[model samples]
Target: AKIIHEELATALGPNTPSYQTVARWAKRFREGSEDVNDDFRSGRPVSVLTDENIELVRQVINNDPYSIYDDIIAETSLCRGTIEQIIHNYLKMKKVTSRWIPRQLNDEQKQERVRLCRENLAKFRDGFWRLCNIITDDETWIYHRQIHHKSTNKTWIGEGASPRTIVRRSKFEPKNLFSMFFKSNGPVLIHAVDNNETIDHDYYIENCLKPVVKEIWKQRKSNGTKDIKLLHDNSSPHRHPHVINYLTEEGINIMPHPPYSPDLAPCDYWLNDYIKQNLTDQPDKKSLARAISKLIKNIPEEEFKKTFDKLLERLELCINNHGDYFEHLIK
Candidate 1:
C-alpha cells in the first residue's frame, strides 16, 4: 500500500489519495468493488455553516479588522474555507492592505486643499484652461535594479507544489533622479539630474524651466505662451521668488498646487509609477534618462489626454471628499 501510494504521488502529484484511503480502496477492490465514489448517504456534508458559527466569526473580525483566515481559525473550530466564506459571503468584507498617501494633513492643510481644488475646478468650469494648455512636471528617482514584485511571482501549479520565491532589492539601492515635464499633447522635456548638482532655484531656472519655456513658445505659436497654465508641486525650488518672477515675465499662468498633495498631481498619481512599472525586467541600460525619454516619446498622445481628463475628475472628487485622500477610490 505504501509503495503504491508513493508511486501514485509521484505520477499524480497532489491528486494522489492518502495512504489510508489507498489501503481501504485496495481492500474494497480485492472484495470485487470497482466503484471509485463513496456510497450515497446524504444530509449536510461534513463541513457545515451554522448561525452560531457565523456570529462567532463576525465577533472575531469586528474585534480586529486585520484578523486573517488563520487567526479566525485559531479562535474557532471552523475550517479555513468556512471562515473565508463567512467573512466574504456572509459579512461582505475582504482582507486588503492600506493605501498609501503622500502625507497626513492637518485641518488647515485639508481646507487649503479644498480651496485649491475648488479654484482649479472653477477654472475648468469657466473655460479658462483647456486640458491641452496645461503643463505639469515632477521629479522621481530610478533605481538601477528593478524590483521583482512578489505578487508577479505567482503561477499555476499542482495543489501541493511550492510557490516561486522572490527577494525584493534593498531600499538604499543606487538610483538616479530624473525630472519629467509633459502636457496633454505630449512630452516637453525629460532629463537626469547630475549627481553633484542640487535642484536649487538657479538649477531650476537654467536646466528645467528654460528648455520647457522654449518648447512652450514653439508649441503655442497660435496663442503665445500666455495661455499656458503651469502646474507643479510646492517644492522649495518651485516656490522660489526668482522662479516665480521668471515665469511671470514669460507670461505663464501659475496654477496653485497644494502642498503634500501627490494625490492631485498628474505625475505623482500616474506618470511616475507608470514609467517605473514599464521599466521592470527589460534589457539593462547604461542610462535611465534615455530609457524613460524613449518610453515617453513612444507612448500614444491619447494616453496623455486621458490622464489630463482624469485630472479634472480627481479635482471634483477632492472637493466632494472634503479634501480627503481619494486616489485609492479612483480606478
Candidate 2:
C-alpha cells in the first residue's frame, strides 16, 4: 500500500488519494471486504467522531464486551449518537449473546475430562482410527409440534400497521423421547419411547439395548461383538447395574465417557444438532413426525463419517485445554 501510494503521488500529485486511503483499501481487499461505502450517517455532529471519543468508547467496550450502549455512554460520558457511530462504524463490532454449554465444570471435572481424553487419544496412537469401530448413542426429546420462531417471521412492518397474529395452540406441547444409536457408517437404531414411559434400567436393556445388540450383530458379523465398543453418556439409566450386566452378557465393550462432558460425545456435538437444523420451527405435528422418520431412515454416510474424524480432533483439543469445555475453541 505504501508503494502504491508513492506511485499514485508521482503520477497524479494533486488528485492522488492520501496514504491513509490507500492503506485502508489495501486492508479491505486483504480481508475480502468489497463494499465501497462509509458508515451510515447518524445525524450527529461530526465533531464527536474524534480520536479521543472513539478511544474512550473502545476502552469501555474492551473492559466488558457485554456492556450495554447506555452503560458505555454513562461510563465514557459520551452522547448516544456518538457512541453508536463509534461502535457500529469505527469499531466494526456487534454485540452477540453468549453460547450455552452443557455444564459449568469445576477445576477437578476439567482435569478429569483431560485425563479421559488423554486415555482416549492413546488408543488412537496406534494409527488404527478406532472411532469407526465405536458405536455412539444418546437420547433427546423430539417435539411433536415445533413452534415458529420470531426470527423466522421477522419483516418490515409499518409503524401504524396491524400487528401479526400468532395463536398459541397449547401451553404444554407434546413431544417424544427418542434413543438413537449409530456407527460411523450409518445409524443402527432410533427407538421412540412409549407415551409417558420412564426410561429405567429394565426399559433401557429390554427396549433399547436388546434391539441395538441385534442390529450390531448384523453390522459386525465379521468381528466379534467385543470388537465394537459402545460410547454413551453417564446418564442414570445408562449407568445402571442391570444395563451394565446386560452389555457384559452380550460381550459388548463399554467406552469410558467423562461425566457431564457432552462436548466429547459424537451425538451431542454433531448428530443432535444435525437433526435440529431440519426439524426446528415446524408447525404441523404429523409432518414433523414424517420428517423425523425420514431423517432416521437415511443417515448420510459421508457426513456421518466426518463426525468421527472431528471427534478425534476434538479429543486432542480437550487435552490441550487440560479438560475444560473446548467446543468454543473449534473453528
Candidate 3:
C-alpha cells in the first residue's frame, strides 16, 4: 500500500489519494470486484523428482546403460513416469551405448622394440650360418589332453542316433621332451621319455645337456670341425654351475639369450609352432610323443638348411622394420 501511494504521488504530482484508498481498490481488484484481478492456477500440477531417485538412476546407468525403462523400473522399484521424469528433468543423461575398444601401441614403443631386435641380431652375426656350429635347445611339457576337431552345427537323422562324444583311447603320465635344432639345419635331435618327476637342475645336466652335447661333440669330431656354440634360454637348469663349467671346459660358445625374450629365439618363434601344427589330431601322450619323435627324426635335410636361412631373413626383416615387433622387450 505504501509503495502504491508513493508511486501515485510521484506520477500525479505532490497531491494524490492516500494508501488507505489504494488498499481498498487493491482488495476489490483481488476479489474480482474490480476490472483487474489475479487468478490462481488449478490442475494436476507437475511433481518434482527427489534426490534419492536421481542417484538411483545414475547407478542404474553406470551398471548397464542399455537397460530398458521397464528393467530400470523393475530393478529400482521406480515407476515409469518417475524414471522418465528423473532422466529428462533431473539427471539429463543421454542414452548413448557403445562397446569399449582398447587402443593400440604408440609409435615410440614400436621403434624401441625394433632397435633391440637389431642389436640382438648384430651380436649373433655369421655365427648362425655356420654348419651344425650352433644348436638351440629347449624343453616343453606335453599333457595327456584330447584334441578336439572343429564342430559343425549338424544333426544326425536316425532312429538310434547317438550324439557324438570324444573317445578316451589311452592314458599317459605327463612327459617332458628336450628338443634341439641346429641354427644352420632344421630340428636334428629330440628325446621323449616317461619320467614321473619334474625336471630339476640335476635332471637337466644328466638327461638333457649331457647327452645332447655328447652327440654334438661326436658329430663335430666326425666332421673335423672346431668347437660349436650352444644357444639356449636361461632356464635354471641351463644356467646351473655344472652346465656352465662343462660348456666352458668343452670350449663351446654359450650365447646369452635375453630373459623373457622368447620371441627372439628361433626355436620359440619358428620351429615350435611348426612342429605343433604338423603334429595335429593328437589325442594322448604316447601318440603325441611318437608323432613328435617321427617329425623330429624325419625332418628333411633341406629343412635344417632353411633354419639359418630363415633366421637370417627374419634378422634382415627386423633390421629393416627397425625392431617394431621387439617393442615388447623394452617394457
Query: Which predicted model would earn the best lDDT?
Result: 1
What lDDT does candidate 1 reach at residue 224? 71
What tens digits encode model 3's per-residue C-alpha lDDT throughout 1-331?
6788788999987578877888988778677675555456787566547787789887997898788998888888988988988888778876764533222335664565466556656666745535356678777665445243334324576888886665553545434564454556555467664456556777776676677667766666665224577778878878888888877776676765545545556777667766765565556667877787787767777876776556556655645655444423322
> Which should have the higher lDDT, number 1 or number 3?
1
* TM-score against truth, every candidate: 0.74, 0.71, 0.51
The local distance difference test score of model 2 is 0.83
Lowest summed lDDT window (length 10), candidate 2: 280-289
- lDDT (Cα, tens digit) per residue for candidate 1, span 236-283: 999999999999999987899988888889998889878877775434
Clashing pairs in 2: none
Superior candidate under lDDT, 1 versus 2: 1
Sorted on TM-score, best first, the list reads: 1, 2, 3
* Cα lDDT, all candidates: 0.85, 0.83, 0.65
- Tens digit of per-residue lDDT, candidate 2, span 83-113: 8889999999888779887888899998888
lDDT of 1: 0.85
Off by over 4 Å in 1: 1-59, 69-90, 153-167, 280-286
Q: For model 2, what is the error of residue 40's alpha carbon versus the real structure, in angstroms, after optimal superposition?
A: 34
